[model samples]
Target: MAIIIAGWIDLDVEDVTDIIASAKAHIDGAYTENGCIHYIWTKDVFVPGRIHVYEEWSETADLQYHFDNHWYKDMGGHLRQFPRKGSQIRKFRVDLIEPVYDPSGTPRADFFTAK
Candidate 1:
């Protein structure tokens, strides 16, 4: 099972390009780290200044390594320069991973939670 971390980060800045550029080094470094499955930061096309972050690690130890890395600290410092409007991040322990699109060409909603 892999550990999944995903979230949204809303910045006060009007443009997210500079922020992304500043963190590029750290992002790249993260990809080279051990047990890193995926680490991505993407801008919201519909909402400027909004950035989405997603990460997956093979184990908790790997995620802990990321938390203690100097690059991670540096990235945090760079991001602090831009005031944040709001942010939300969550970690999940995934037991099973599946694609939303099935082999039969049907979209599956098996993971939906009823309200």
Candidate 2:
């Protein structure tokens, strides 16, 4: 099963733009980890001082390894440099994977390959 993490972080800085610029190293470093499908952090379109979090891992073991990596450990200190507010991040264990478009070339919301 795949693990998906999605949510937002409220930064205490004046603007999220500066923080994202400083996060380049951490973001880039995550891509080097094994079983890392995607890792990203960006500012929300309508929110100031808010950063949206999104990540995908192959499995629990992969994510566990990431936790022990230096990149992961350093990110905490980087973020704590500023006075942060509340954060809401959630993790989901996905049981099925499928394309958003079906064979007929039509987009659908329901799962077509779940059986």
Candidate 3:
């Protein structure tokens, strides 16, 4: 099943401009991984020193492989340079997948593919 790794990190580095700049290469490298569907790290508009992270992998095993990959390791080390108050990252196992809109473009809350 596909999985999502999502959360936020609060840091002591008031401005994360340099951190984000340095992470671009590593972030791009992660996208080259076969299992990566989407990966991103962006700043929270209303919060200073906060970076939001989101990553989706084809499967749990793929995410495990990423943990040992150079891209992940490099990003970890790069971010380690800055002081952080805490982080709340978590891995989510997906149960079902569906689009928010149907053919008519109306919003939907029920799972069309599972039933």
Among these predictions, the greatest lDDT belongs to 3
Using all chains and alpha carbons, the TM-scores for the candidates as numbered come to 0.87, 0.93, 0.92
In angstroms, give how far residue 54 of model 1 lies from its true place.
0.8
**With candidate 3 superimposed using the best TM-score fit, by how many Å does residue 36's alpha carbon deviate from the native?**
0.8
lDDT by residue for model 2 (40-86), tens: 89898788788999999999999999999998988888899888888
**How many pairs of residues collide in model 3?**
0
Between candidates 1 and 2, which one is better according to TM-score?
2
- Model 3 residue runs over 4 Å out of place are none
TM-score result, candidate 2: 0.93
**lDDT, candidate 1, 37-95, per-residue tens:** 99898888888899999999999999999899986788788889888999999999987
For all candidates, the clash counts are: 0, 0, 0
Sorting all predicted structures by TM-score, with the top scorer first, yields 2, 3, 1
Full-model lDDT, candidate 2: 0.89
Ranking by lDDT: 3, 2, 1
Query: Residue 92's C-alpha lDDT in candidate 3?
Result: 94
Tens digits of lDDT, candidate 3, 1-115: 9999999999997777678888999999999987999999998878889999999999977888899899999999999999998899999999888889987898989877677
Q: Distance from true position, residue 64, model 3, in Å?
A: 1.1
Task: Enumerate residue pairs that collide in model 2.
Answer: none
